[model samples]
Target: MKRIICILSMLLCMAAETVMAARAPVSEATEECLGCHSSIHPGIVEEWQNSRHARITPREALGVTGLARKVSARTVPDYLLPTAVGCAECHTLNAKVHADTFEHNGVSIHLAVSPRDCATCHTEEAVRYSGNLMAHARKNLAANPLYQDLQQQILGRPVRREGKLTFEPPAAETRQSGCFYCHGTRLEVVGMETRDTVLGEMEFPRLSGWPNQGVGRVNTDGSLGSCAACHTRHAFSIEMARKPHTCRECHVGPDVPAYKVYASSKHGNIYAAMNRQWDFSAVPWTVGKDFTAPTCATCHISLVVNTDGQVLARRTHEMSGRLAWRIFGLIYAHPHPMNPDTTRIRNKSGQPLPTDFDGTYAAEYLIDAGEQVRRTETMQAICLGCHSASWVRGHWKRFERTIRETRSDIRAATGIMADIWARGFAKGPDSDDSPFNEAIERTWCDAWLFYANTVRFSAAMAGGGDYSVFADGRYQLSRRIQELNDWLELRNQLFPPTPPIALRGLPEKPYRVQ
Candidate 1:
């Protein structure tokens, strides 16, 4: 027994030495960074120490072949290939191009690390993500005037004025904390600020959008998207990125309740119950082997394989690469946009919406039928990893039916809103008043934005429980439509009718006095 115990101890010591040897040497610059940070910010250092970046060099990563390969760059600069990815590796890369670059402890370093720097070793992922809608999230939301109005209605401060609620443009801090929290903020170096640090007074760039990790963050290097949004900072752990909790940070809102719907799903239930037994770090993540259930990454981005090691789906950084429909409708569900920059799209009414108020799509800006079919097949392939063809087909049939039914519901609500606007009961698009500001108009918006969105998510994810019936689903949808009709009736009864306003190129009011 004593001889066996000694042998086991010797083996463990050898294993520890092997692990230490496998870790690529940290560069001299990174060593300097760690000299101070390892003590000053011990937590950050510890997390990074446990990351894959701490263990492997670009040279070793690039040598890996097949679907298991993580690094997509074919060749890395000689200077970078020899070192483990560390503070200096990422923060010092392309320093000349970064406007926020500043001398930090005698070394040039940028506060915000952009995708452009990461593209040094992840060329394919960076290029692919550049085409994802998430990469253009800030521009898609902020640049579009129509969306700006909607944002104002949702985030603006409300005050009662002249017996009605009027909204003030939200403060910059308000926007930073609200919608921009997920959509990302445009970061810029406003000026320099001096701070007392462990090493005494140090001058650092004061970034306007500091501390943001939103998916579409505009970095100081003019790069779109923040890889840290998923991979996380310091550690950049693949295990954390593969977990649904990372996605839950941004997708838990009522407007886009992907996480909420997923939490209620059978897949989510299985994940919640058995996730501890799963292998989140496995490359070519095998369905039913690595994970018995899907996380957000599993269905959207992860490279998946079958039990027999056959490739099921290729890894993707373009989150919407397999999506046929953009279920998060502005007014109604429509096909996915052709370009990631949805700001370039305009409807017939000259609105920067994929679909007009009446449900006509901006066809030229959206993906064509063939593209949609291809994307649908791609998504269906992922489904087939766990489900039979008949089951997958049936699920899609229900989802398609839900989209059609919800569109009809929204059309009904929009027609009611148009009637209210025509009768001059509320301000509208033609009258220079925000269409989303009024109480009734907000209710109309809820029909599509909240309730319809929840229903679609529930159907699409096959998590058809209260989410599809009660929790911001069909019940709320039916009640919201009824409430809009009631609101218009109440408004008519409360006030004297004036002559209808000029049609403003809209159709005649759909109702008249008896």
Candidate 2:
């Protein structure tokens, strides 16, 4: 019995030793990777070296308190705790699970690091961002039939061929450079192909919709968004994400124009002049000390702090937390919707609101009124950091009034278009014919899409007098209305009015001379 007991103890000790060896940190392997990559990609190596990732080991970071503890690994293997973040740490964590991993010179590597991989460390941010509008941007825009119809009508050219109107789709190059650049394109793996390199022949993923960093990118591993959209590659600098130029990648246009309006504002001027002196890397970004004026991130995403270093608000990946109203004013000005899932929402009339109304805010599909008010107050609190309460209140009042005024103008234009459609001057709204092909419909679209959006964005951002008055604002609004009236009058003359039907029986006998 003593011999059997001793034999059992020896076996248990051997099993424990084998498990520890298997769990040992791959820091030595990481060093070998850096040794070669450091010479081949020195700039990337330098950037990583400067990053906080390289400076702090998992063990050191796990020992800290507060936010540090929250972001650190909850339970790191004993072997990995001592190594600073490096190439092998990320690429080889779970090699067998990835679909696109390849073996190179006796090491396994994945070409793409998916959100699932990043979530291993940034669990909270990954989850929050998964629900963000940006994560579903491709589906919301591409999956909607109405949006596709508009895209085909607007982006494509219509020509009368063989006595019938035929739509010619836009060139592939134009779409790739324009809309899809930001809205994201669906990715597909064509298959694996062999390529000859200095290392010898190797197999690599043949992918489409690649070399893109659009926010809603559909990665090969089935993730929804690209962290690189804002963070950028290897460096993944916070400063880049916090700047306005990064957002300008998609937001700068006649319809959106957020970055354009902001660039011309007083706050933009201050940022341009003094941003070099500011410390963008600081946590709990101080309002006065870190920056005198607000950047896009400052107002939307950053965890702001007072001058005394007291936190005023927590950071958020869900950007809509402070936005009460969506100023895009698609058909008319409306409140922000609950989520980006346009398919499930319906309006008061029981019709599909997302397909019919451009910007109608379905109350049931969104957060309650109380929650909206709270969000509005949260935004106002941010404004209070620089302006007086009265000033903030007055500014918001003006902004609200501006939205109402813009909606009124849009309604007038809509009436004219509806009248035109009713009288058969153009194809009716519900007809199979394309509503946007005619001259009048195009003009009406511009009224709501371009000019009205400019006025609202200008008002909301406090863009100076010039933008609201001259640069596609009130002046364009009035001009567009006049153009619509002129077109209607000309169309009436061309068609001519039909004579009134002759009255039957006794009524026809008494015709008065005018």
Q: CA shift at 433, candidate 1, in angstroms? A: 1.0
lDDT of 1 by residue, 1-514 (tens): 9999999999999998987787789999999999999999999998898789999999889899988899998899999998899999999999999999999888999989999999999999999999999999988888887777788877889988889777778988888898788889999999999999979999999999777888888988899999999999888878999998999999985888899989999989999999999999999899998999899998899999999998888999999999999999788999999999998988887777898878889999999999999999998898899999999999999999999999999988888888888778787775666778788888988899999999999999987677889988999999999999998889878864655445343432221111
Mark the regions of model 2 whose C-alpha exceeds 4 Å error after superposition.
1-26, 67-80, 92-98, 157-160, 163-166, 170-174, 346-361, 496-514
Candidate 1: RMSD over Cα atoms?
4.0
TM-score, model 2 to reference: 0.84
- In candidate 2, where is summed lDDT lowest over 10 consecutive residues? 505-514
lDDT of 2 by residue, 179-222 (tens): 66787766666789999965568788776776667777776678
- Give the distance in Å from residue 218's predicted Cα in candidate 2 to where it truly belongs: 1.6
The TM-scores, one per candidate, come to 0.94, 0.84
